[model samples]
Target: MSHASTAVQERPTPPGGPGAPESGLSSRSLPRLAPVGFAAVAIVLAVGLGLAAGWHSKVQWGMIAALFFLAISYAVTSVVENRRQAKDRLATSIVWVCFLIAVIPLVSLLWTTVSRGAERLDGYFLTHSMAGVLGSEASGGVYHALIGTLEQVGIATVISAPLGLLTAVYLVEYGKGSLAKAVTFFVDVMTGIPSIVAGLFILSIMLIFEIQPSGLMGALALTILMMPVVVRSTEEMLKLVPNELREASLALGIPKWRTILKVVLPTAIGGITTGVMLAIARIAGETAPIILLVFGSQLINANPFSGAQSSLPFYIYEQYKIGEAASYDRAWAAALVLIAFVMILNLVARGIARWKAPKTGR
Candidate 1:
């Protein structure tokens, strides 16, 4: 019992408890009661309110009550656990709700359209033209419109794709002069111009040459509208191609044009195809230009250069304008068909792009 022993005795270790010096109570050990308490209270209140409101139906009010209870329960539990954590949970819940809100409308629209539109999308719809359709009865199918759409749009792609790709290549590879700048500015301006204006431009040009509005005129109008989109998308994709690839080709003594054809184009073909498909999708659905430039006809027109023709979009418009119930049904059906075709095209393009994308892994 010397001086050190006396000091230890004077300040002996306190008994282990809530106030213990060595066994201090954890902040967590405080009862997490508030969240559970609030949840229980909310449940009771919700039930009482539901009963008071006389919600008898199992399908309507029952579902509503259940969702309300679930939301409240989660909110209360999160709050009782931790305020900061609860805030995050609340934000996550809000985001999920927003997502569902957006997705539900699209789902509903698709469901409704498919349910109604399935009636008209049959074998007959694909094979027969609407040339014979007349009077009260919806007598024929949309084959003519489908054919015209493909032929006209096909010609448009033929016209626009090369021109667009070359222009983009020029912009990316060699055209950095004032003329290039001017071209870029004009493209930007063209992109913002209204679709109807493009149609009218083609129409005016045709009138100047004493040519009539026809599917070819429509194709030309669409080409003008689509080229800028193609140029913009292709330019972006080409820019993404590594400069290193270009330099390596140049180092091999490949001429610039050959390098572009053999090396650069191959590397970026996937993106280029995707961009082209996107441009096609953009123009394929355009109604104003085709309607203004290519007057609708019921009979199938094989040659775009000769006479007036129709497209799926204009077909839909024409069907709706007939003001008959059968016509309206056909319009919905045609819309569904158009959407399906576009979706198929996108899928095919994606598949081709993925299948042929340059393999980096050995």
Candidate 2:
């Protein structure tokens, strides 16, 4: 035979095949059914263990199944592929499990609230008030509480929004040195203060001044609770506004304050408004502050500055405390209304955000 032909015949094959690598790893992926298959096996095992052990809780069984799924997935992937791939799959499974765990309670709460509250929600329940209706009677409404909530929240927002915005502006735009740090520290401290603490703080002030319990007093406590939230949120939003926008305005010979007013604020206004609304929503359902300051009233009181007032949350608590079937129904109904109110506020804030978002030509 010729030398060239002999050389060709003596040449060795690749490790696996003609195009295969020397490494044992394959380019092919696991079957798409792998997760489903593992889940099925886990479910079977979990169910068997639960039945055999007489475990009554489905939650326990599901948790066991989830653990099995994670373990089996990691094991099979490690055996079939490599440790790195196995770790990635395990991490993904863990993330999904955590997400499911977090979402389950939220979904359950919404479901329970909606199902129970829908029974007594009606026009009569909304437009009328508990002014003359007895707690044990089935004829009361939440109108007074609704009015009080709106007025108090409105007053609180008015009091806090501007102060918070100005504070945020100072922090983001021109704040410096020890003063700025002190303000920032206090804002952080205030943010973590409990609602009850805020209520008590206001109650102390009220006691010192001999002030009466009224919607305005509740609003003052709410303002104190809300300002820190607004400051934090608005400060973050202001920080998000590109510095280039401010520089551009400055280059045009605009004053620093004007630049902030016309450019910086407009840029972050959507977020600021949303934050303010969220703050309002946060305070809207506070019962402690209302109880301490507003001193819940069964009768309607339109004036916030004088006389005891009613709020949706306080009204719910009062009705629930009555422990009667009618009161329970009213409480649930009021809760539904309050939830709807907050939901509406959120929807409106979202709508405003979309509407006011900076226009960019696509």
Candidate with top TM-score is: 2
Worst 10 residues of 2 by lDDT: 20-29
lDDT of 2 by residue, 193-268 (tens): 8899989998999999999899998998899899999999999999999999999999999999999988998889
Lowest-sum lDDT 10-residue window in model 1: 21-30
The TM-scores, one per candidate, come to 0.79, 0.90
CA shift at 224, candidate 1, in angstroms? 1.2
Model 2, C-alpha of 23: deviation from truth (Å):
9.2
Model 2 CA lDDT for position 23: 39
TM-score of 1: 0.79
Candidate 1 backbone overlaps, count: 0
Pairs in clash, predicted candidate 2: none
Residue lDDT tens for model 1, 118-222: 987788877877887872476678888898899888988999999999999999999987999999999999888888999989888888998987888999988
Kindly give the number of clashing pairs for every candidate: 0, 0
